[model samples]
Target: MRLAWKRWIFSLLAACTILSLHAEDEADLEQPDDVPWEEVKSTLPAYPEAGEWLPFFVTSATTNTFYIDAKSLEGTKDGVMHYTLKVVSENGAVNVTREGMRCSTREQKLYAIGDDRSKTWREPRNNQWVFFKKWAINRQLNVLYDDFFCPGRIIVYNVNDAIRALRSGVPVSGKSSRD
Candidate 1:
């Protein structure tokens, strides 16, 4: 009878230790590293031509139509995805931006802004990576993060994968690829 009790206790302790170790591993995955993040240098993309812009759906409340330049989609070696985005307002004004998104950290950084008149790109004065905000009025980054580019917190495997997700209107992580 004493041997049976010892075995049961041993089994319980072993299970507890395994579970504890698994929990620690999960915590480690969730924690950010103490090392400062260094962003890879990005080059500004050319101004998106009207024909190259592919429209994407954002929130219904927004009057602006969002688009991604089909030709500008790029996946970098450092896990940063670069693309040029275009925003067309209902009033006929257009805004273009070249940006990079880091799927692992849910952060985005603006690389440059496009001038439609001169067809030139200019760097933003405050270019930096910022986390996506849940309550932002314009949830373009969130839509891209959750529905297309960074689904499941993993970036699309390549530029073609990103383009596929954009064209199919389905997330990269989705079980079914519409296209």
Candidate 2:
């Protein structure tokens, strides 16, 4: 009789715990979805110097070569990773921009553009966070997010980890290329 009573009590406790968790989940689901998320203020970094550019492979299909500024990589407290990107096309046209990526939402924002002649940064007209597209022509940001900075949908721990991941061509957290 004692063993049976103990078993019954244990089963009851387990069921009660499961129901409580379920109730909490239901409450969470009932909350409004329009709650605004707060983002940390961003201070734009200086334009990347010529020596700070580190080439990263995105895909072989495109003739444009992509590079990230080693000195501009930063992991912010709000989980946003900021960096400067430089793209050189086969035709010799070069484009440079400062950008930020949020691993939590898989979104990217263009902060500023670099003027090669003045070696200065200018704020982009549309400096809004937008979801990454699936098209092949714009795969540079996606590659950076998937391979180096935000593998497994989690941001790197710090700037050093991000630089390490870039240099090694893999994620620092041990997640595989596409995990």
Q: Report the number of the highest-TM-score candidate.
A: 1
Q: Rate the local accuracy (lDDT) of all candidates.
A: 0.73, 0.74
TM-score for candidate 2, please give it: 0.74
Model 2 C-alpha lDDT per residue in residues 1-179, reported as the tens digit of each score: 99779768876775565455422122322213465666788787766665477787776555688888888888876678888899999998989998888877777899999998898988799998887643323778778887778776677857787787778877666664434
Collision count of model 2: 0
Clashing pairs in 1: none
Consecutive 10-residue window with the lowest summed lDDT within model 1: 22-31
Q: Estimate each model's TM-score.
A: 0.74, 0.74
Steric overlap count per candidate: 0, 0
- RMSD per candidate (Å) reads 15.8, 17.2
